[model samples]
Target: MAVAPTPPGRRERNKQAKLDRITAAASELFAEHGVDDVTTQQIADAADIGTGTLFLYARTKGELLLLVQNAHYASALERGRTAAAGTTGALDGLLALLSPVVECNRVQVDNGRTYLREMVFGDPTEPHHAEALSIVAQTERAIADLLSERTRLGGEEAAAMAGVVSAVMFLNLAPSATADASVPEILATMRAQLAAILPG
Candidate 1:
C-alpha cells in the first residue's frame, strides 16, 4: 500500500513558526531595553539565530522595530474588525474597534508606548515613520466610516472626530516619566475622554 503524502502546508507553517520566534524575542528585548538600545546582533542572540539569519528577515534594527509594532497593530485591528462585524450600530462598532486597542495597550503597554514614541517624534525621513503615519491615517478613515454610518455626522466631521480620537489614544499610551499608573486607571480615563467626544 502507498503511504499517505506529507501535507503541502508544512513549509508555510514552518516559516510562520520562525517568524513568531523572532518576533517574540524582539518584543521582549524591545520592552526591556528601548528600541534605540537594542541591536540586531542582540536580537539574533535572543532569538537563538545567527545575525545573518536575522538580516534575512529584517534589513535593519529599525525595520525589526517597525515589524514588531505593525504586528501588534495588525493583530489588534483584526480583533477590532471581528468585534465590529457583530455590532448593530455605529457607536457599538466604534466601541468594538477601540476595545482591542485598549486591551492591547494594557497587555503590551511598555512595548506599545515605546513603538509610538519612535514612530511619532522620531526622524521624519525614516521609511517606518511614513509607514506608521499611513497606518494611522487608514485606521482613522475606518473609524470615520463607521461613525458616519451610525450617526448624522458628515464625512468631514466624522473624519475630524476620528482624528481627535486617535490623538487621545496616542496620548493615553505615552510612557510616564515618573510615577506609573495602573492599567485600569488608564483605560477608565481613555473611555471617559472618548465618551465625552462622541456624540450622544
Candidate 2:
C-alpha cells in the first residue's frame, strides 16, 4: 500500500492559521494594553501558544508591531488604489486615495495617532523606525504614480504633489491631543489646504 502524499496546500493553510492566530491575538492585546505594555508572553498566552511559538512568529514585540502596522497600511493602500482606478480626474484620484487614510483613521483613530507619534518622534535608530520610514516612502511612490497617470505632471512634480498630499493627510489624521484639535477640524483644514495647492 502506497502512503498518501501530504498536500502542499495543507502546509500553506497550516502556516496561515498560525499566523492568523498570532496577528489576532497581538491586535487585541496591543489595542488594549498599548504596544509598549504588551509582551510576547502575554501574546503567546492570548493565542494559546508557547513562548517559543510566539518567538517563531515574532522575535520581538517591536517586530510584531511593525508587521501589524505594515499589514494595516498595505490593506488601506490597496483599497485606495482600487478606488483611484475608477476615478477620471487627477483630483478625483487623489481624493479616492485619501479615502482609505480617512477610513483607517476612523477605525483606529487613537491607536493610529499613537503609532504615528512613536514612529515620527521616537528613537530614529530603532530597526522598526527605519522600516516605518521605508513604508511611508513606498506609500508616497504609489501616490506619485497615481498622480502621474492622471495628470500632466513630471515625475519630480508628481512626487512632490504626492508628498504634499501625504503630509496634509498625515496632519489631518494626527491625534487630536497631539494637534490640540479635533479630527473634523484637522480634516477641514487639510481639505482647504489641498485645494489651494492642487490645481483644478
How far is each candidate from the true structure, as Cα RMSD in Å? 5.4, 5.0
Cα-based lDDT for every prediction: 0.75, 0.74
Across residues 71-110, which tens digit of lDDT does each residue of candidate 2 receive? 7776777888889889887766777777776666555556
Candidate 1 Cα deviation (angstroms), residue 8: 16
TM-score of 1: 0.72
lDDT of 1 by residue, 144-181 (tens): 98888887789999999999988877787775741165
The local lDDT score (0 to 100) that residue 198 gets in candidate 1 is 84
lDDT (Cα, 0-100) at 128 in candidate 2: 60
In model 2, what is the error at residue 91, expressed in angstroms?
A: 2.4
> Per the 3 Å backbone cut-off, how many clashing residue pairs does candidate 2 have?
0
